[model samples]
Target: MTKNDEKYLIEYINLKRHEYLNDLQVLLGYAQLGKMDKIFEYIQKVIDKCNDERTVFNSDMDSIMKYIKNKIEDK
Candidate 1:
């Protein structure tokens, strides 16, 4: 990805870092529109969410990260 792509991805992660769930939904909507850039962006958000909610994903963190990483990489 280019620098701006990286920047937006990090921005997405930052939003999720604070648990902005509603906004996350909107961003995810954009991602689902086949907007690879936006999908990559929201994937970072999801990764951050999964990271911050470790206790909630105690058994799935690794798998979740692996899946998300694959999606991001595939983009």
Candidate 2:
């Protein structure tokens, strides 16, 4: 891939990773509030959300890398 394409991909990945971390922090805040049942419920939701996000990010990054590989091959 070209230098610009590589740079853009890195930036996008970093941005998404930052957002995911922020989401986890919010969920952790909910867990720390001393409600047993509610904390478990929130933790479960966080687990599900993290799983979904992982799948999506993996798919997206896979696609981006494939596209870059194709571009490099074409040149």
Candidate 3:
């Protein structure tokens, strides 16, 4: 909620956006080279990495919710 926190969050989002754009460019290069196998492998790797990130995000949210739930249980 603080201005500093907001600024950091915005920076993080922009950094991630740039990273995704770079990834797409890499994929485009592979396609231009007609490397079908490499393209598929790269795509699979990206998907797997995204899935792993999602799992970590989910677990983090679960922990936050658990803390809130425990607080409510005590009231």
Candidate 4:
């Protein structure tokens, strides 16, 4: 592929990665707010999306929790 094409692909992947991270953040926020059901439902949606894409997104709860904690602490 051309350098320009690779650059565009990188940008696209970065955007999608950030989108997934944002979704995870929202789900974690819901979980912390006593909305376990909502969290589970949203998590299932994330899982389904990952499965359909043949990708594994953050299977480790500790890492996921750490990311959320860092985001919360950053503010």
What Cα-based lDDT does every candidate model obtain? 0.62, 0.67, 0.69, 0.66
- Which candidate model has the greater TM-score, 2 or 4? 4
lDDT per residue for candidate 1 within 1-75, as digits (tens), equals 666556655754765555566667777788678687877777797778667657544656456455445445654
Ranked candidates (lDDT, high to low): 3, 2, 4, 1
Question: What are the TM-scores, per candidate, against the unseen true structure?
Answer: 0.31, 0.46, 0.68, 0.61
Residue lDDT tens for model 4, 1-75: 556545655665666688788997898799789999999898898888768544322456445444444444454
Best by TM-score: 3
Residue 29 in candidate 2 has what lDDT? 78
Residue pairs with backbone atoms closer than 3 Å in model 1 (clashes): none
Model 1 scores a C-alpha lDDT of 0.62
Candidate 1 runs further than 4 Å off: 1-32, 55-75
Position 11, candidate 4: lDDT: 61
Best by lDDT: 3
In model 3, the worst 10-residue window by lDDT is 66-75
**How badly does each model clash, as a count of residue pairs?**
0, 0, 0, 0
Residues 1-75 of candidate 2 have per-residue lDDT tens digits of 678778766766666577678877776776787566876786788689768656655777667666545534553
Per-residue error (Å), model 1, residue 63: 24
